[model samples]
Target: MLRRWREEDKEPFAVLNADPVVMEHFPATLSREESDALAERVEVAFDERGFGLWAVEADGEFIGFTGLSVPRFTAHFTPCVEIGWRLARSAWGRGYATEAARASLEDGFGRVGLTEVVSFTAVPNVRSQAVMRRLGMTHDPAEDFDHPVLSQGHSLRRHVLYRIRRRK
Candidate 1:
């Protein structure tokens, strides 16, 4: 089940970030302080917006997080909302990311009334790309960008954008 993040979730989330395999696509593993701060921000967003990165659980285990976030970083396409997800190494290949992310998209387009949603990943992150495709998102290569927050030459700088519009 998916639910809002809680303070108690920080430890498990930190563990998720600590996994080398899970952090491989990311630039670096998040420090415990960073993970706690992130969880606090997610909780605040949920309080203000009614939705944010949700704690994904199955039979009372913390799988990871999945939800919608307003992209704050500058991009070729700025000021867009995005649906995203991340899972622990143990959760990889289990369809949990896809399942939880689909629910996030549904809530974004259906409940939150967003007309469209976008997602992006580093150019080499095929796992995320596959999940985006499974969610019916279409690539817009023209919108691909070098992530502004990363150094210009960073290995994870280039990203591919994917988008999906809600059906009328």
Candidate 2:
């Protein structure tokens, strides 16, 4: 189930962020303080934008988050809402990300009135790319870009972009 973030989610979320395996595709794992700060930002996003990453729970446990957000960094896709997810390692392969993301897309295209949504990740993140494909998002190599937040020549700088539009 997807719901607003709660104070109790902090502990589990920190653990999820700290897990090296869970953060394998990214640059590095987040510290507890960093995790909490991110959660706070998510809350602010919801208040400011009316939509942000929703905490995902399974059988009453905080698994992760999936929803839409505006990318902080400038890219060709800047100023666009993006559907994203990050589940705990244990929650992988459970279809939670895909299910929650579908709901996010629905909300984006429905109530939020977004005509399009994009998803991107490091080129090495085939797992997330697969999820994008499962959601019917299409990719064009020409749209791929170097993540502006990363330093030049950084291993994770290269990223692939995928997009899906609201059905008429």
Candidate 3:
């Protein structure tokens, strides 16, 4: 299920952020303090924008998060809303991320009225790329690029971009 983050979500989210497997694609794992700050930012984004990455619940527990957010860096796809997620190791192998992301896309295209949602990941992140494809998003090899935020030659700098347009 998809909903806004509560104060209760902070601790588990912090631990999720610190997991090496979960943080492998990003620059580094966040400290607990950093993760809490990120949760604060997500809450603020929802308040300011009326929507952001939603806290996910399954089996009555806060497993992880999935939803839409604006990418903070400049890319060929600047000004796009992107669908993404991060789940705890315990939550992997379930359909949760795909399911939550579908709800998020519905909210984006239905209630939020966005026309297109983009998702991207480091080139080697086949796991996330697979989720993106499962969301019915399509990629263009021509659209791949080095992430501007990563230093030159960083291992994960190269990224694949996928996009799904709102249905008529």
Q: State the TM-score for model 3.
A: 0.98
Q: Estimate each model's TM-score.
A: 0.96, 0.98, 0.98
The residue-by-residue lDDT of candidate 3 on 56-159, one tens digit each, is 99988999999999999998899899899999989998999999999999999999999999999999999999999899999999999899999998999999
**lDDT winner among the candidates?**
2
For model 1, the stretches where C-alpha displacement exceeds 4 angstroms are none
Weakest 10 consecutive residues of candidate 1 by summed lDDT: 70-79
- How accurate locally is residue 159 in candidate 3, as Cα lDDT from 0 to 100? 95
Per-residue accuracy of model 2 over 90-167 as CA lDDT, tens digit each:
999988888999999999999999999999999999999999999999999999999998999999999999999999
lDDT of 2: 0.95
Tens digit per residue, CA lDDT, model 1, 1-168? 898776677899999988878888789999999988888888888888877888999778888899998887876676888888988787889899899999999899888999989999999999999999999999978889988889878999999999999998
Assess the local accuracy of residue 8 in candidate 3 as a C-alpha lDDT between 0 and 100.
92
lDDT of each: 0.88, 0.95, 0.94
Clashing pairs in 2: none
Question: Can you list the residue pairs that collide in candidate 3?
Answer: none
